[model samples]
Target: MVNGDDNNARITNGNLAEVGQFPYQAGLNVSFGNSSTTWCGGTLISHRWIVTAAHCLDGAESVHVYLGATNISDVTEPGQRHFIVDQSGIIVHANWTKSTVTNDISLIKLPRLIAYSQTIRAAILPRLVNGSYSLYEQQTAYASGWGRDSDSSDSVSPVLRYVAMPVMPHILCRMYWSGAVSEKMICMSTSSGKSTCHGDSGGPLVYRDGNSSYLIGTTSFGTSMGCEVGFPAVFTRITSYLEWIREHIPDLP
Candidate 1:
């Protein structure tokens, strides 16, 4: 993946997603004050709230959100819904540090509540274990987005894509990122030529526990060198911000 404010993170070496495959996936077309448009990914945590990376909202004048669509451009796609939000509805974390990409999470409030269907729904939040969020090192998780298909690609994918990655140990992640990897972040093991490339920022890292899938992480950043360079991709650990999230969106489901 690329920088948080850069529209480069994407699902490199991933598979095309089917309709209703990622009901919680949200495609964002963020427009800046200068009229430049950038792409980003988001997760629907509730009918009225969308969770994404704070950097995605940097200088964002407006956000065009597309839900329930495999092809973001297909407005007539079955169950597709669209909504527009401005800065008034956006909320960036107070502690978000753009320099280090720390606490790179944010929430977007929809103008109106959306009805849930088979193709549109909220993602499940993770449950705490022993008063702390559970960590799942070595476990597999899925990341979906409409970001770039490759590091060299300038355009993001029109259709949704996803990849399966394994969770790596925090210590191992720290070894790669050094002190840059904080306890508030989660890392996914990377393979050669396989990663979340540019345009994948703010997407969900979902883990399946039993029959339920929980949102574990939000795409933050990958190595500046490139997404497929074997360094673990860092994410804003969703579990680490459960309290913060609940405080903002008290009715989270």
Candidate 2:
């Protein structure tokens, strides 16, 4: 599986994103040195770093990152920039556990600094309240990726797609997922068949606070049942790893 069947990824029942709509979005092609390639999404947090899911780098070797392009296949897209990175640049969280899906965040270093443009920019990370996240339940957040459009699809979407989903209370999500839910995770659920599926792992879940958008979550996992089954889509809470992120990307703005 590209994004792995074990970990949920992608956007189902989403709208095709316009060029430049999500300037911080990044499409990743991961190669495992055996001609095996998988896809994942990421967010540009700074000119030299991208934040993504640790699972996305599991058993991976190299990554080809595409920035500022909705269409991954189009190399000629005006604002798009491509960079190839080896495993040396991939940084998975020290406590990341694949079995429990805990601490599922990672940071990738760009080989060189990138210039920001209208179609290429970094996202704002949330400001912690007393060293922790403030509840934003009931607020609408947007998830964007180039993952599969449906559960049955074997390939990833050709264009970037996004869906608007409302954040669910942690208590409610815990009730649904039982012990699988953790404080380091955030969740969103919808009844309209809008959710992440395979190939969207490591993608961004953005929350707009006032006039600025915050990179609140990174695509983690969803129910094993399916994407549209009224289950909550889980993400690695960015707010919970601020200090970890700062430790890695010291120049983070």
TM-score of 2: 0.95
TM-score of 1: 0.95
Q: lDDT of model 2 at residue 103?
A: 93
Each prediction's RMSD over C-alphas, in Å, is 1.7, 2.2
For residue 59, give model 1's deviation from the true position in Å.
2.3
User: What is the lDDT, from 0 to 100, of the residue 92 in candidate 1?
Assistant: 88
Q: List the residue pairs that clash in candidate 1.
A: 8-198, 8-199, 9-197, 9-198, 9-199, 9-200, 10-197, 10-198, 10-200
How much is 188 displaced in model 2, in angstroms?
A: 0.5
lDDT of 1 by residue, 1-253 (tens): 3454343468887889989988999988889999898888999999899899988887788999988989987788889999999999888899888878888999999999999998898889998788767788999999999888887777888899998889989999988987788999998988867778688889999998776778999988888787767778888899889899999988776
Global lDDT of model 1? 0.86
In order of appearance, the predictions have TM-scores of 0.95, 0.95
Our tally of clashes for model 1 stands at 9
lDDT of each: 0.86, 0.88
Runs in model 1 lying further than 4 Å from the true structure:
1-8
After superposing candidate 2 on the true structure, give the runs of residues whose Cα lies further than 4 Å from its correct spot: 1-4, 129-132
